[model samples]
Structures are given as structure tokens and as C-alpha cells.
Target: MAPTKPLLLDGSTGEGGGQLVRLAVALSAVTGQPIRIVNIRANRTRSRPVGKRGSVHVTGGGLKNQHVAAIKCLADATRAETTGLSAGSATLTFTPTLPPSRLPRRPLKIVPESDASSAMLIFQAVLPFLLFADVEEGQGVEVEIHGGTNTSWSLNYEYMDLVLLPTLEARFGVRVERELRRRGWSQGPAASGCVWVKVYPVRKGESITPLQLPIPLGKERDTRGPRDHFEVESVDVALVVPLRLLEPLQTALARDIAGVFPSAPEIDFRVVEDSGHQARIYVLLVAKSPTGLRWGRDVLHSPPKGSSANPTSMADALSRLAVKQLVEEVDSRGAVDVYLQDQLVCFQALAAGRSSFARHGDGRGGGVDVDGVAGAPGPTPDIEGDGLRREKTHEPFGHGSMHTKTARWVAAQLLPGVQFFNKGDVVEGAGIRFA
Candidate 1:
């Protein structure tokens, strides 16, 4: 049974960004719970000089355009009621109708008030609700998000299309088909674009499959010493830049990939699209494991305004940086990128059973078992009894990025039944069923 009083959350805690609000609302809708969040996006308030000569600094905070758009879209889909659904409201109360109503058959559309708002951020906010929505069999929910597709400090469209969507489908059985109508940019000149996504919700009476990311050298037969590293089987490079810089970008990318993974087979490099503006240049490099896991890194390079920099030099620099970051990621041997690790916390908490993955991509396979409670440590899986009881002294869940910790904290607040262990490498889920 649903609780009578609304759950209260402090928006200033943890990551203290718009994502906290997004996850809170989506979980509230899915679980048919009411929530009240105070001090929303409190830490996100920023002051920057905007006027001529950078003389005056204007400060802005609270819900942004994309945040409101996501909230409204989820509210409409779930027939949920909201209080303080405005541009800069500090508090929000969201109450979803109990026993979730059936979502409409037609597609839903969302347009942010600002062209610079990230469409992917909006998509992330509503994905959980849509994945568990009450939809008919052989049917999918369509969402058309019109805003900045490649905005700064957010996941871009190509990353979603190439990395996130595929990983979700393969690991969790959640499928989403994407269609990009046009490119949007926040760099150089700001322009709005559209991305249509058709999400295939989990079937009635079924729950999302628990994610089980493979450990690098846990195999019994391949005991080739203890130093086992993550293997990169293939590479996919996607570029979007001006027509003139395409050749140099390609050349630089190829050289970097060769230097990084010369032994790896199957490298596919291509220009997915051409950015019309000289200021807009983006590169994404994804490394795939034989087990189908992917780790990706990207950079949306925006040269200094009015700087007379060489375009070819700029392209080469961007390629080198992007590839260098990717090499670091691969070297880390993480099951997913740093960003994706945190993003999966919500799913792990809501899924049907235990979901376990690697804690660190350090290539050395080991995990420190964690207690269900936060900040407390538990026993090591290999150790025994009272001797190992003292092992729980350290902060067991302190491995992931702040974003990861924030997402994990949000999941814990919304779904109390879920338990985290192994520094968030293992999740005992709520087993939430859509039907």
C-alpha cells in the first residue's frame, strides 16, 4: 500500500543538480508515491557576467527549462499532479495517481523554453517511467524532444544512439529506437533540433533483467597470472564537424586510435554528419569488449570566440584529447564509463533481482562486501566470520563519482527496499513489476 504522507527530499544534498529532481519524480510516478523536494537545484545556482564587457554577473537557479519540460512530460504520461511547476520554483510536490493509468497511444512531444536546454537530460528524466509504463503488447511509447541535442556538459545524441541505447537493450532488455531529424547546438551559434525516440516498455507482468557486468579475469581456465587487463575488441569513431575539417579530424582520429589500440581489430571510423558552424565540433570514440560491453568518451570542442585558430590544428587537438581520455577510460578497465556507472544506479535499484558489476575498472578482480547501510562497511566475500567483521570500518560505498553517489543516494531515498554493496558494484533490487 502507498504511504499517506509524502516523502520529503533535500535538493541541496549529494549531487544537488537537476538529475536529483528528475530521478525523484520518475521514481515517484513509477511507485505511485508522493514526494516533496525543497531547495531544488540549490547547488546549481551560478552567477556569471553576461552584459557588455562582462561587467555584471546575474545569478540563476532552481528548475531550468529542460527540468520543467521533463517534469511536465512525465506528469502528462502518468496523469500525475504537480505543484510549483515553473521556471524557477524551489519546491515541488509531485503526486502520481495510484494504480498508474494507462499511457496514451499517440506520441508525446516536449520542447524546452530555451534552445540551449539539453534534450538528452530531458530524456534521462522520463526514461524510467516510460520503461515501466502501462502500455499494450507489441507497442512502444514515442517521445519527441525538441531542443539542444549536443549541449555542453550533457550527454549528446550520438552517445545515446551509439553507446547508452545499445547497452540498455543488451544488458537490461530495454529497447529504444532513435531518429534524429536534425542537429542542435549550444556551441558557437545556438540552434534547436529534434530527436524522436520510441521506447519499448517492459512487457506487462515482466520486470527488467538485472544487469550483470562481467569481471575481467575471474575466469577459471584463463589463469595466466594475476595481472589481467580489459581487452578492446573493436572501435567505433563518430565525428561531426565542418566539411573543411573532416579530413584532418579523420586523420587525427585514425592516428590516435592506432596508437592506443594497435592490436585491436575492426576499427570503423566515419563522419556521421557535418556541423554547419565552424564553432561546432564533436568527436565520440567507443571501445567494445568481446562480451559486448562498451566504454566511450567524447568531447564537444568549442573554440574561443573570435579567436583566429587554425581549423586543422583545432581538429587535431580535439582528436588527441578525445582519444587520450578514451585511452584513460579503457586503462581504468571499468565496465562502463564514469558517467554511465552512476546513471545505471536507478535501474539497478528498481530491477527485479540482484544486479552486480565491477566496482573499479582496475582490471584486478576483487570487491569489498558492503553492509546495506550507508557509510558502514561489511565483510569481504573471501574472508570469514569475526575476523572480517572489522573489514567494514572504511566507507564501503565511496568508490564512484559524486554523480554516481548522488544517483545511488536518490535511489535509496525513493526505493527503500533496495540495498547496495561492494561500493555500489552489487545491488539488491526492489523487484518492481509493471503489471
Candidate 2:
């Protein structure tokens, strides 16, 4: 086959890293457009921990194992053709035998090489393409991935369970059934861990539906409605720890939340005897809003034996991290949480129709004589001709919406027509069809 007029990509583009490669390849597979990615993961470099098991340094700077795993896994599952798919390779050319529109009839499976490699990362790459797949007549895509479930530096498994799956299902009508046979943390007692998930597409050709923004953003002269504030309906927590330690941790978290949330929001705590690994504790917190927005945060660690550890301190930190993050996300008044904002950019772009969403701003109506700023922060909400400035502290986490801007830059690079603006966020494929 002559080259497929590949969509060109630079690994070092804005938010330059593995996600760009993962997303480009996923789009390639779904659109059946052969992809050519250079400078693959150009901006990402990590030092391999001096492993006690003699794991050595990763010398070259290029595609990481997880990126390779995501591509190869999806390709193999679909019997796709490819080249330049080796560890640390700076370029990749991938051609799927059939795009996701014409998915094969079977459950696709992916297993990474290292027990420490992240399952969530691989899932990010696989999911977009999978959304367009149908395993049987009228059935959605079915897939199973076995690898690191809660590895460090990647979104943990529960975030998908608490935030992503529910949001996709409710907002987009995507159906999925997930099962976690085993859980894996980066440095736990078990050499490796696993999670199993199955995704059903929104339809055969389209995997995702366009996002419905709470408020539309197209006209500068338009009147504004009251912004949708994410209200916490409840908080559900899961702890994987030694069964004996559950009660103390639960009691401590309950007390902390009572003080943190003076409103006394409903809280549910569940404990699992297994930490999914040999670790003594892994805590997951899921806070859901009445309108279905969600924010999740978790912490997992394998403490040294008999150290100067206080159960009170550990429990306090874990619970505080979870509840506190949820507070920040909800306070931002964003339709989605901070972490979800970045990843959703790709899905919005891939939708078969125009997709729009509310991109949260700091709500300052105007800022310091903003002029001709092509990508300037939005004007303050509900303010006109007032020279009042709401002081912003240097603390970056105060607003909690970070990477959505970087996500916009990435979208501009990969898909020329897609616009991720403050208002009227849209992704249109221009009627291009692949099957």
C-alpha cells in the first residue's frame, strides 16, 4: 500500500509526551489513517529507579514501554500492520488492517511487559479506537487489559471507576462493564497486579458522543446564565489494607471529613481485606456531585517494616488528600475535575459530530488590560467596566484546572480543525468516514 497520507505528528508538541503519541496512534487506528510520528515522546525523560532486582538504566530517549505496549497491543488485537514499534524508537508508522469502524468480532486483550507498567496508561491509548468497535452485531467494543492498575505517575484505576466511566456512560451513552480481578501498585509486595475492563461503543462508527456544555460560549454579546456549580452529593471511599487496620482508618477519615466539610456531607466507607498487592494500605476516595460530576484521588504505599509510622498520621494524610482534592475541583465550578479536563480533549476531537464543553476559567471578567491575546485567559464572569481585580494567590492548585490549556495546544497540533476554546469547544471531523 502506498503511504496512507499519514497524519504527521511531533512528539515534542505542547503537552509533549507519551499522551500525544498514544492519542495520535489511537486516532490513526480508528480513522485508518496511517500515522507518522517523529521525535516520539521527545520531551519526556525519566530515570529508572535503581532496582533492587538489578533493573538497569534506560539509555535512549524515545518511546517508552507503555506507549509501545498501547500501540502494539491495539494493532495486534486488530491485526494491524506497523513499523518502528520498538522500545526507545523515536519514530513510528502504524497502519491498522481495518479501522475501528470495521472492528473484528472478538474480545481484544493487552498485556504489558513489565508488571510495573501502567494499565491505565495503556487504556488511555486503547479506549478511543475501541469506542468505534463492535464485537457482535449491535454490541459495543469488548476489550480486556492486564497490567499495572494503580501504578505511580499515572491516573489510578479508581479514577476511571469513579469519574470517567460514569461520566462517559451518563453524558455520552457509552456502555461498559469493568471487573478488577487483581489490583497492582508500583512498588507493592506482589511482583505485578491486574485489572479487567470492557467498553461498549456509543455506536458502530462513532465511539463517543459530543459533550453537552452546561453553558454555550459562541457569542461575546450573549447573556450569561448562572454557572453550574459542582455540588458534592456524597463521598465514597475504598481502602485496601490489612483487615485489622480498617476500623481505625475509617474512624479517622470520618472525623477528618466532619471537620473538613462543616456541612456534614454524606460519606460512605468500604474496606477490602486485600490491598490488591502486599502493601498494607491503598486508599481511594470518590466524591460525586448531584449533577454527576466526579473527582477521585488515591494514595498507595508500601511502608518499611516497623518504622516510626503512626497509623493516625497515615490515615489522616490519605483521607485529607482525597477530600481536599474533591473540594478544590468542585470549588472551581468546572463541569469536570482538573485531571479529567486534559484527557477529554482527545475524545471531544474524535467525536463524529461537533462536541462542545464548558472550559472553566478563573471567573475574572477582565484581567489587566487584556489585548489581542489570541489565547488569553477568559474575561471575568458577570463584570462590565469595573476596574476591580480579584487578587489571585500564587498557589497553582487553588483553581485546580491546569492541563486543559495544554490539551488545547495538543489538539491544534494533531487535528488542525479542532478548536478547544474557552467557549464553543468543538471537534468536527469534516465528514471524513473510515470503515
Candidate 3:
């Protein structure tokens, strides 16, 4: 029998990057649904300087090497049928292998051509399948990928290792690990990198758990807005820098981070070999909360032009970026960081139960997790949202408001009955299942 026609998506939706495509493919694999996306990378347009710096010309919209590479990797993962799977193609179709439970037995490998391509983006694209992969007892899926580890617009491996995965372990019960075999930078597409990941499948009959937002110690509802009380329990910062700036940048960053934490959280700093062709600085900030989970943000050092830049500026730039981001995230009052918020949207929706978390905002207040005692905010599969719907508002759930908006937009489009609210930052999953 012919497969049902897939859901058609507007590639211009949300941020118009590969996110919508990734979400669509992941869900399609799980739900056994086919999806077709038109106008790939429609949110972006091709632009080049016509002459002077101030002058530029728009040459219409198109897909980039990274976008093409991402979709291809995902297509290979599910052994899916696809059309328009080449660079610059504007329309794409994906038909997953039937039953939505089949996965590769051998280690899956995907490599990028340029250094600027994000391995993290590719990893993020395929992670959902790994989480729910079907494997024999004592067996897990292995993925080996090559791309930039520390790049703009994607989470670094450290964030995944120290922060994001840890949160998954604590909150969602996912068992995963990462091994960095080589280092890659995002200065441009020519730079190269490598990373390996092993995701242990959940036991038979077990399902992914939902995310739950904590209420306050004595409060009925959370009112913390964007900034809330998330105590910093630990701090792990890793730096891979050139030999010339190693000691200086390391020492300077450590001192700067000290002032950010008044409670004297456990802080550790390490200096490692620099990766890639050019000398660069990489910083990973993994902040943990005893009452909640880990929140991570990594800052890539902007290379100094000529001989004018010094060690102080390098350390200061990343230090400022790291400290300021952590503080703002703590204040945001959301359950996860803005970046992590994007990562979790798909998982929360795919899981089998109810999940809730504090929404992001700039105001102040408090709340606590009431799950264990109350057995979560509501029942499994469907959640009731009283806040403003995504279509009706512009408020973001967390960081990169547009990104959170994008995730919600993708979910709403692909998963019917899945709704996200503005004020509450609460989401109702589509109750997606593989059986």
C-alpha cells in the first residue's frame, strides 16, 4: 500500500533554518508520518555585496551546504526515501521506514565538508532518533561525526556532556555519552573536527518521561517571570587555547568568574590543547542547580585581528559573555536555558507524560517542582494550556525568543493538538508513539 501523503510545511516558518526540517524528520521517524517541506531555508536569503560595504544585492533564497548535509544525514539514519536532497534544492520530501521503530545496527557516520559546518547541529538533528532507538539488551547505537565542535549558533560538546545530557539523566532518564576525538573550529567552512556519541536505548516497554516545572517552597504557582531562583551548585569551565594565551586567559577567566558567584559554588578550570588550524580560545560553562538541573552556555573566542588584540581582551570577551549569559539565564526563571529550551521541546512533546516548566521572562518571582508528590502538573499525553497560544503572541519561552518560537511553531505544525502558550511557557505534546 502506498504511504499516506506527508504533511506539507512552509520552510519560511519560525527561524527558517534547518530546525523545522530536523523536527519534522525526527517526528516523522517516530510517528511513521511522511513530511514535505517547501522553500527550504526560506527564512534566509542569498545576499552579497554589490560593491562597497554599504551596498548589497539580494539574490533570492537558497539552501546552504550545511542544510543539505543535515537532511542527508537524517535521511540515511531512518533509511527514508527522499527527494530534493541536494544543495540549493528548495523543496524536500522525507518518507520514513515503516513501523517507525527500525534503526541502524552498525555505527552511523556523517561528516561535513567544511569546518564552518556545525557538527552540533547535525547531532541535534539526529539525537531524537538515538534516544528512542531500538536495540538488543546491553546494546546501544553509536554515531561518529566530523564537524566544528565550537561554533556559532550551536551548542558545543561540553554543553551536551556537562550540562544538557546531565539534565536529561536527572529529569528525563536518558543515558548518553560523548567522546571528543578531535577538535574543530567555526572560523569558516574549511576548518574540520570530529566527535563520537553513544546513546543507550531505553529498556523495552519504557517510555521517555515528561519535563516538569518546579513550584516554590510554599507558593501555589510560579510567579518568577523570566528571572527566578536557581542556585548555582557547581561550575565546570573548560578552555582549549593556544600555548601563548593558555596561562593568561585561564587565570584571568577564573578570577572573573569568581565575582559572578557570591555563594562560592564549586568551580574548576582546565587548559587543554588548541584544536583547528588557527590559535583560538574555547570556554564551556556548565552550571548546576541542586533543586533543578544543569544549564550550560559555551562562548567561542573571537579571534583578534592583526597584532592589536591581546590575552586580556580574549579572556574578558568570553568571560563577559559567559558570566552575563549565566546570570541572565538564572534570572529568566525558565526551567531550562534558552538553548536547552529548544533542544527539549521535541523530547518533551515526544515523551508519553505531562510536563511543565517555568516560562522565561525579565520580571521577578518564584516557584517549585511539585511532581513527585503531585505526580506531575497534569496527566500524560495531553496538557491543558491557559496562556496565550503561539499564533496569538510573540513572547518567547526562553533564550533567543525567536528560536523558542521556532520550536513551538514546528511542533504545532507537525504534531496536531500540540499547543504552546506564551504566559505559561507550557506545552502539550502530541502523544507521539512508535508502536
Candidate that scores best on TM-score? 1
What TM-score would every model get versus the actual structure? 0.86, 0.78, 0.82
The worst-scoring run of ten residues by lDDT in candidate 2 lies at 391-400
lDDT of 2 by residue, 185-208 (tens): 676564555667777665434335
Ranking, TM-score, top scorer first: 1, 3, 2
User: What is the lDDT, from 0 to 100, of the residue 330 in candidate 1?
Assistant: 75
lDDT of 3 at 399: 25
Candidate models: Cα lDDT each: 0.74, 0.61, 0.65
* lDDT leader: 1
lDDT of 1 by residue, 1-435 (tens): 345578898888777888889889988878878899999988775555577656443333688889999988877776677898998888998887753336767789999898888999899988888887677787888999999988888989989988888877766878898998978899877799899999998888777776444444544555554322356767898889877788888888777788778554467874467898878888888888754567889888877778686767877788889988888887765557777777787787888765544446444322344322211122113222221221121121445677777777878877877776556666667878865
Better of 1 and 3 by TM-score: 1
Clashes of each: 4, 4, 21
Cα displacement (Å) at residue 140, model 3: 0.4
Task: Return the TM-score for candidate 3, rounded to 2 decimals.
Answer: 0.82
Q: Compute the lDDT for candidate 2.
A: 0.61
2 versus 3: better TM-score goes to: 3
